[model samples]
Target: MVQKIVHDWATGKIYPHFQFVFSFKFRDLNTLNCSINLSNLIVVFYPYLRNALDYIWKNPERLLFIFDGLDEFKSKIDFADNCTEQQHKCPDPDVRCKVSDIVYSLIQHKLLPGCSVLNLQPSQFLSGFLMELLEREDSVRSVVYTFPHLTIQEFVAALAQFLTVAPRNIVKLLSEAHSATDGRFEVFLRFVAGLSSPRSARVLEEFLGPFPNETTCRVIDWVKEEIKRQAGNTWSEFGKRSLLNTLHYLFESQNPALAQQTLGSVETLSFRGLGLTPIDCAVLSHVIRWRFGLLHGTVISRIGECQIPRARRSNPASGLVEPLRLLMLPTSFSRDYEFPM
Candidate 1:
């Protein structure tokens, strides 16, 4: 079981982080909130987390694992049952064990040999697991550090609003109004969803990026509607800039259709074989710029250089080839195509 878990994490198939493993709620009959607290620790890990496995792997001996605030370690441990020094650091032999039992095994020089660990606390913390492990090993020890003060009052005051007030759910409202063309509202929803700001979008990527396809499509649709509703001339532009940012988000979604869907009237500005004509070259260039005028440079570059197959919806349906960043599609039927760098 341990080996299997390690293999999966090494291959990037599972969430591989030390905190993730530590946060696991082992089977315990003592507490009502044991399981709930473990899952809630996940909420704590959600905001910011560091994957320390790689660094630990590289220098097991030199690395010192500092686990601050031991009081936060909610689950109980069986301090006596140290796995008696076994091999394998990542998952050990089994995970069907308590947090303390696992930490005990690691402390016994069973997992990640030569690695040292130190525990810090606000006061004389008494976890049998830590005390037993430290006594069991001469090198291991614990220390209590004192701090001046942490202003939790101000933090709580700031956090109270978000905890009390509900979010403005525009998606449901827009869904009702734009039922028929709801799919076309991704731009507007993206703007609103990100709080219509670049900084907000970056933060939201973690929370919202991994949403399922159905939810993603719906949010994209609602955003599209909002963008269209706000569209106007770019002289004192408010909408155009937001529209551009949202369009960038759409392409980043890796959903090919959303990229194509944004061009309402000019889904296919077909330039097949027509680029040879002077008038066609001028007109096609203009059309490309006008339709995809708001997208980022990479999107524009890929779209411009990529060889569109004779069909958008094609046979054998190899699906859309990944946009080759520097590959140019041949204007003619010849496969050997080249464009200036």
Candidate 2:
């Protein structure tokens, strides 16, 4: 429902007249000082709103406040606390109080009674299709089970892009995902890349419906541009991880020609102080095979238990004779292993 509201607002389908519609993450709100009042808070967070403070005070109903990710809120909300009684009687929006008190007052209709407040948490059903897939009920209990693995969930999110009628801006979505600090969108981006394959699209169409061929092509093109953009610059650890993720996305696409074209000029590949899964190793091997002649000095360090298969480590068919170097390996797998590149 929050998403729907946001979408409607964005498209000017609802709240068209409202000039002050503020959306804030619950975690960001929790950082407010205890003595801050609604009036000061608005100016502190949004200085432009300072000019409209009097208007806001008089016409609170015109403003819509949306608080998202309540499930991640660190503080508990106690509706029956003694502080509620004090807050309820103090109806002035400018009165200084704890941020929690302000939240309670707002919810209880004591402060900004005419304004609308929307609180969104993950426990609430976000989509009917998702509810149908994950929600189950029995005689005594109800439960919601997520996909067995994180990758499956990410893939489903990626699939949702094609299922929607609206044209997806692949570059914008990728940019947003790339900027996220939590690594939440890493696998989802890879799945988006994988879904670009015609074989994958046809398989999905058999069960879901026809996917927009143009969107898939756009994703492929974006992936190529991203790889090319990063190829020239020297990368730090974080950037190296991003390059590795790009390799994974390319491998997921299963387009050998695309991989070769995008990564043909890559000279050195370094994945230092990073944990690698068996799947990650496989993806790395695919890139190595493509750029065997051009790539030199591939450095992998601090890979604890991720064992690269000896056969995959070397490819005799490629007829390449570049000595592979393993640096700072764990005691268990200290022996020299040939890398295909």
Candidate 3:
């Protein structure tokens, strides 16, 4: 539902207002092919490009090209060069190529003129690619604006519909929870933070409901009540307020995928170039390394107990290594904190 809302919003605000059209995707771009170049891409994306360009040429706002997961596509390409090919005859161009081929062509200037391009991808990866792309003397960089994870206000507004709670109440609850948790607030807040998108909400619900045993519920309820009492506030204080603000920062930073879903068809999404303070990076690195070590130890011990003969390991095609790798991968809570951002 939120995806629909955002698509509508973006189309209303951005489409038919720009002059040029350019798009890029990571996979076979077969779904976005058009009659003009149907042989090189997907056909489903044709209307989008047509409408977008029409809006740009007919209106003054220019156009905003919302490209998503370019980094993911790049990763896919790196891992499997010809990953998403499905043969289909083009009605017009009569040529045959993967969807990714078409997207690459557009980005390479096989499309119309007077257009801007927005490449969305993971922050760190996007930063590196954009830096490289912008290095050329004719490349334009300043027009691009990379939006960070959603702001506190945007988060609040996004969650407001599903929560049915006033903004102030949410804020008050978070404040009270923070004071009562004795600094375990980050863990608690994770349970309630998320946008209304199905994927984002699913992640949030899992956090909240993952451990649904009686003991977990009791802990949650007790914490809520205790926080309310300690904060000297009414039971109303136990509402969603505590989750609203810190969640904006915590959930968005913790789950960029969720952030993208919540924010909708944005031009750029990236984790690189994040202005993390030196102290913050230092602390994060320490925590990550410690967790990695603990998980590594657990894995090595598990593998040691396995009864596989040493000579079997010498078999070139033996699968022992893969399972051992999985067994050793970190399962600790602190370990996962490093990846979500």
Candidate 4:
């Protein structure tokens, strides 16, 4: 259907006109209390179609109705119910009925049966931009080269957030990113934090004009507060993950003073059940070096016993000191966890 429409548009056979109907407009239609017939709907919401009502009715097959942001639609659409049965359907274009009934009849194909109806959610609407990106030759080549790695994707997402989001709301954005426990935003959060640094911001400014200083400051400040909060609760899994995340953010910023202010009072660090990745250990090693030059009295229990050696092998200069106390638990008891050095 979409291909045919595009072909028609290209060949100048049909000039498509867009009629926008937001979710709020549907609510308004329901509350108007006046006759909610097709002619009135055309006159009120789709004014351009008012004069072409007869033409539209005669050639309903040529019409395409796009219902976007279906996720935000408040009213229930019961597909199984016979509420819009043959007798209740609005057969005539000018027939009056409840707004919901009209919608039901349209969707159930009792009205304008030959017309195309497209339903889309917010995410699906945004995916059109990604489709454009995928259509580009350079972007396609980049995708092929980076097959499984999501680093570029994460970086682009971070960049998009910075470019679009306001400085005042940056704190809230970071907070929401930090609160995600599934680790889906882990690398993305790190990119966001890395972009907060003056050096990184300056690099970005060369291509995208002046980056906002207020947003960077807000992100930095939010990281500090999170570190402070996570430092006090390092025993729990959530605290361990959050503290590790903040440390990565801190390391990304390359701010020694921020690191010292946040981690100065901490004596002992615990990373028991958390499975430390090489990247996690590298960040941990950097943060530890930044804190004490050489961290002593470190305790790594269970899974860290295996991960630390691998992290050390990957980066010998990571300076992952031998654990003073290594308690190895059985594999059955192991759980994924994270911690700061």
| TM-score of every candidate | 0.26, 0.47, 0.26, 0.46
Clashing pairs in 2: 313-340
Give candidate 4 regions above 4 Å deviation: 1-150, 293-341
The sequence of per-residue lDDT tens digits that candidate 3 reaches over residues 127-227 is 22222223212234323433343343243333332334223245456456566634445443444433422455565444222222332333234333433
True-structure RMSD for candidate 1 = 18.7
Candidate 2, residues 1-341: lDDT per residue as tens digits? 45656677678865654556776677888786467788887787788888878877787656777777776777666666565455554367688877666767776667876665656664333332342243222222212245656666787788877765555676798878976767889889988988888877787666455777777878888889877775544346576667767778788887878877887666555555565556777676666555543244444443556543222234578877545442333434334322322
Identify the leading candidate in terms of TM-score: 2
Model 1 regions more than 4 Å off: 1-24, 27-214, 230-233, 266-341
The digit string of per-residue lDDT tens for model 1 on 84-173 reads: 332223244223344454455455555556655544433322221222222222244422222222332222222221222232443565
Q: All models: lDDT?
A: 0.37, 0.65, 0.35, 0.60
> How much is the lDDT of residue 327 in candidate 3?
23
Looking at candidate 3, what is the lDDT of residue 216?
30
Among all candidates shown, the one with the greatest lDDT: 2
lDDT (tens digit, per residue) of candidate 4 on 198-254? 788786665454666677778788888988888778777778778878889999988
| Global lDDT of model 1 | 0.37
lDDT of 4: 0.60
